[model samples]
Target chain A: MWSINYYGNWIMHNIEITDLKRLTQLVKDNHGYDFTNYAMSSFRRRVNRILDLYNFSSVNGLIEKINTRPAFVEEVVNEITVNVTEMFRDPSFWREVRDHIIPNILLNHQSVNVWHAGCSSGEEVFSMAILLREMGIEGKVKLIATDLDNSILDKAKKATIPVKNMELNEKNYIRFQGSETLSKYYKEENGVAVLDPTLIENVSFRKHDLVRGGIFNKFDLVLCRNVMIYFNQNLQNEVLKKLHESLFKYGYLIIGSKESLIWCEIANKFIVVNNEEKIYKKIRD
Target chain B: MKKRSIRRSGIKYCKVVGDLGMSKYKLDNTYRAIVLGGSAGSFQGITKILSSIPDSFELPIIMCLHRLKHVRNGFVEALSIKSTKPVTEPYDKEKLKKGKVYLAPSNYHLCVELGNSFSLSTEEMVNNSRPSIDITLETAAYSYKKRLIGILLSGANKDGALGMKAIKDNGGLTIVQDPNECMIKTMPESALQATTIDHVLKVTEIIEFLIELDKNYK
Candidate 1:
């Protein structure tokens, strides 16, 4: 099936193996989003989604537009990053970290440094702060939260949450054995919950790209939840290596409930602390 | 070797110019096997039939269900809750086993070639689908030639009809859900007209027939 390719979009009856190779090249050359080892099905759907949104009559047209417009490429790349997250997302996972992972850190390390990579909009940072405070470990914890999106970081710094999300947020918070209602954490006015400044006193929000580099020395815990699923396997493995290097000896790494280190080259470096919660503890080399 | 012939007949062949380095397997006449393809309104009927079959039932059931891309990982959980037999999404290179049902994940084509082992490919969208009904049924017909039972259930397209006909031509059983009984009848109706279907039954009767076949044959 012969086809014309412009920026990885092919106009053909079937997706040729040659087309995939060309797509890989185009992504690298133009967008810098190397999708070479991403699951093929996932890569196809994302391309299709982009085509639909752009309202291109065919893949050819979409490619033409993308080749001509750099902003379009940026939008498409952002769309591909699935950044869906929630506050204190999995309560059980947080509980496991608090009970099992944190105590081990307290034993060897008098002070702790934590990095929450891909920390979208700071709900999770606040949640982590609350956890540390409740444990009387807040003073000992230093957190540096970063994500690729500066807009999200701005929102995170503001600590303002949409009013509608508060009800469910409160429910999830209480389910996590929160001693006080979520309403107590933020005063409601003008349809926004301005998070208490105290929760983020030791926390710093920055624009850090996982695909690029994070400028932090060492940390006890790296809580990167629900952010890697959208990453191509190569990117996932690369990011995992960076996280592995960043963790202090015997430090912890936590991923999404569904995410795993099984397929990574560094899978043997960490022992699973809680498999279902996806909490892993770094072991000595 | 003619492009015109392929375009006219709706069947195209790409002669392997060189070895693609894929391992090949061969099998002789296999035992009775069921291959099912459905989408759109497939979940209810498929879950019911799959969940009703016992683990003791001695046949392999390969199912393809269409799903929205990147859906949560509760399909096995849901199907396991509903099915009497164990339902699992196939891991890459996992060997095929009997008495267990395999469900294709949201966005991949699931095919069974010779040797009864399943293969997943992301080559292209067939009939506008990744987990295409036609791809699954067609590959099974190519492999199981005579022992296959191809079933077309509730779906919104004509994906399985041509593949179902291939199964019948290979001396295998071709079944379709009675159009009236199907939540979406276009696919079942397509199969009935395009192929020599051996049976057209309601979902309940299909389950009963499977049970009876398992009891008598196995």
Candidate 2:
């Protein structure tokens, strides 16, 4: 291990195989961004990508660079926590959310509290909003859309998407059997699709890290699609535990179509409402 | 060897070119995966290669092939007929194992997810193909690094060239099928031009090389 001076501070610079936990700890300590709970394989892969992208000598050099350049931390956080999602991502999953889960959630409560955790860029949040509006329950919902990456949250908050993305969005809308033409929800001008601002009237966008953020509020429906697959099993279990705690008793949880809760300890705590679409209902106490 | 005996056969084999260097093909201790990619006139070559592998071959072989989007079934089943190792389309989040051949499911780009399992994505097609050869190869290179083996076979497009180069850049072994011996030389020709490939062998030699690699790893 060697030492180096960068930006008038002695940053630890070494060529050894730096411990990933140590790196994340350094980030947590210096930047207050916690990543220790992430799966190491992906954590390591992203670090390696950063090393390649920036031509860092090693993980130490990467950390040293991060220590010196405060602005780079945002880039790192954005890349690491990034989950690319699409509107109506899985057509059938949205169908189930509309037909099966939403009705069940509305059965026990006057309104629905839908939490879109790790809601990258708010695609899923918009999907849920469309469903709620179509179901005539838009006025009776509180939707909290949260992610660790604030830049993405900002984009989601704006709720406007590029016009080109409308092709697949419209395709999915049709596949989902949405009540109205997909164009009725958004106006296109100057090559941009402007969603109705009212779509997000009840939606709140916030920055929240699923890895460390504990339970804060209860939700009748929690849609955390396609995010946990990025996490290792232990972290998945921990986050699922946290999500389980955040749900109202017998509240519905709809995961990504590809994500499975089969091996999670909470698997027994939820009944499989629809396994293919990955919708589960909390077991009543 | 006759190529016409295979299905959709447009395969034509020329002379097996220059000798494969034994030293450079070394399978080191860290090696863990064997990723093979191909398109357009690849079935014959892939079948021949898979059929030639010894029963003792134990690497987790992942294959990405560019077929028409409408190919719903039988691609893996066809390969399993000739593969001594079992071949099956991978389910989402399916765990990896040795001595198995995993096919990238249609309409999805396959990625090596965090848990050493496979994840499928319907993200927009890349290089005009859903099961983009480059996406799978690049992700495998990232996950396995120096422990990866990426082999690009015959095709009509330039999908796997950059990805095979990525494997080489990451210290993983890189192999490309001999362009002169392929039915459609565009893919292999592109890959050969992309990076300093370690091996450029014919279908049979590639198969034997894989068997040898398995032995070396053990």
lDDT of 1 by residue, A1-285 (tens): 101121133221233335555656676687665556544434444565556556665556656777787667666655554433457666777777778788888888898889999887788998888888888889888999998765667778888888876775776687687766777778887998888888897688887777766546788899887566545456778888889999987888998655668778899999987877778888965
Error of 2 at A100 (Å): 2.0
lDDT of 2 by residue, B1-218 (tens): 24323311322221122133343344555688889999988889998888888867888899999975534567778889988878887765678888888888766677776447876655446667768887788778767888898988889888888778778878998888877778898998888887888877778768766766776666
Candidate 2 runs further than 4 Å off: A1-22, A48-62, A69-72, B1-31, B40-57, B66-94, B105-135, B138-147, B169-172, B181-184, B202-218
Task: Count clashing residue pairs in model 1.
Answer: 2
lDDT of 2 at B171: 90
- On lDDT, the candidate that comes out on top is 2
Query: How big a share of the true inter-chain contacts is recovered in candidate 1?
Result: 0.00
Residue A46 Cα positional deviation in candidate 1, in Å, after optimal superposition? 2.6
List residue ranges in candidate 1 displaced over 4 A.
Answer: A1-24, A187-194, A212-216, A232-235, B1-48, B51-84, B88-201, B206-218
DockQ scores for all predicted structures: 0.08, 0.17
- lDDT tens per residue, model 1, B117-185: 555544345566657776677667766778888888998977777778878877888878867778889
